[model samples]
Target: MEKSLLKQRLLELKYNNFQDLDVDELLPLMNAMLKYIGDTDPDLRDTLIYSSFSSLILEGRYSNENLRKLLVTSVSNDYLFYGIGRRQDDSVFKRSFSTLIIALILHVNIQKNFLSLVDMEEVADRLINYLEKEVDVRGLVDEKGWAHSIAHVADAMDELVNQKLLLESYRKKVMQTIINKMCYDDDYYLFEENERMVVPVISILRQGTNQFLLIEGIRQIAEDLREKYSSDEKSCLIYRYNFKQFLQSLYFHLEAIDLCEDIRREVKKALKVINQPYYAIT
Candidate 1:
């Protein structure tokens, strides 16, 4: 529990490049040291925790019951770790650790069908809440010159949908949220953060390659912009948004995903409408 001891253990576990810190060794330490794992205050032991969890999840070390309990309890107790319903920027360690945990859920647990002991529905709900409710506190850029909150949320959602961990209804809801956020161009700071979401949102849509969702998402965005433009007396401000570039990115990514013929045709039609004056809508 002591700061010095926590760091020492972490260094020991991290010794020889995690070669000696296998799952068999990690679960016990995590069980005894979960409270001391992350930074609650001056203790900068989060990196040690992050490194340990990263190894555990990435190395497919979910076979142990204690480890499963550790993950579940950590999420349940510390929403900040995963940014679930969290409005402020988490520590760097927490941000990256949250991402690792989500990746573990998507790849190791869901994909490999491991962790039958873990309540995945609860996990899914937490992830969904993270995407739906959490607020961004890390402004346009941190010292690193990029925001991790949106990117992490976007990446996590993309993985879930790609793995079919989320249902169609939930996927649609997430897509709508992403679209709305991206189209809110007036919030330039948040818009830049939303820009980090575009690729992953497109990646998620590419899973179905249906193009219907893409078309609808675009139409909804256009409608939103039209409403904004009209409300502002048809201001040229809407023209400054550069949604055409976004559509071009969508088109390129969808093509890379090898969209079906019908979907491809729909995409072409949508793009034509998107590029036209008044977006061919007014």
Candidate 2:
């Protein structure tokens, strides 16, 4: 289908509240949407395509089998990992938007239980690997729209950790991955990337991750920032500032939530370490 025709059809579907569409009719549209999932046009990609997927999934329009197919396709190279290693390019749209779709699938699965433990584990593994390789941390491109790769993957991880079938080990791995991404040295996250990243941390904490391990993750972030503080390079300073903001934001988030006293205290201690001056007071 041509892009213009697809947009018109999607607009009509949206106008009618996405109702009364037969499965056969919707499938073709869905396939077309998937093809343009990485389109640089914000109206088509975000407003029409992603919003349509979210509405259909939340409305239970797709069957379990269909949802599984969507999940698999979203995680595939054509979508989530498309042009993964390249930085500051249009391909980030595909990868970032794919994570949002995966997140919607995971959210629905938590209630419906259509996905298996193995399925969830694969998602965790793929997401962690994606984060490790993803360098395009661009949030909102000037003309193209949002390419918030880190924030989008964080949303997927947040939903993934909430699955009852997911293993605790995977949760630990997810937490560590989040920390590593927050401390990424390539670029600073001006988007609410830190806030989105914290959602998964809260999810894992609610699932009862080992307090010691959680504290250790905090310490590791602090230690990393300390090492960077010793450097006078401009990039090192950017990393230091970004890392400190994440810790501060996390501290406040912990304060608002209950049953996180130990982790909160550790974060507080780490903040103090982060705030220490490089030179002694006169």
Q: Which candidate leads the pack in lDDT?
A: 2
Q: Estimate each model's TM-score.
A: 0.67, 0.96
Q: Lowest summed-lDDT stretch of 10 residues in model 1?
A: 184-193
Compared with the true structure, what per-residue lDDT tens digits does model 2 show for residues 134-194?
Answer: 9999898998888899899989999999998999999999888887777777788999899
The alpha-carbon RMSD values of the candidates against the true structure, listed in the order shown, are 5.2, 1.6
Model 2, position 68, has a per-residue lDDT of 95
Model 1 regions more than 4 Å off: 22-25, 28-48, 64-67, 80-96, 115-118, 137-147, 164-166, 184-203, 206-210, 230-248, 257-282
State the local distance difference test value for candidate 2.
0.87
Which lDDT tens digits does candidate 1 get at residues 1-282? 566776787777677666776546665665544554334432343356655666766676656454466556745536334444444444433543464456555655555654542355555566655545544535434333334555666666666556544556656666666665544333233344444566666666566645567667666665555455545542335332546455555566657776555545654665555445556544
Estimate the TM-score for candidate 2.
0.96
Find the number of clashing residue pairs for candidate 2.
Answer: 0
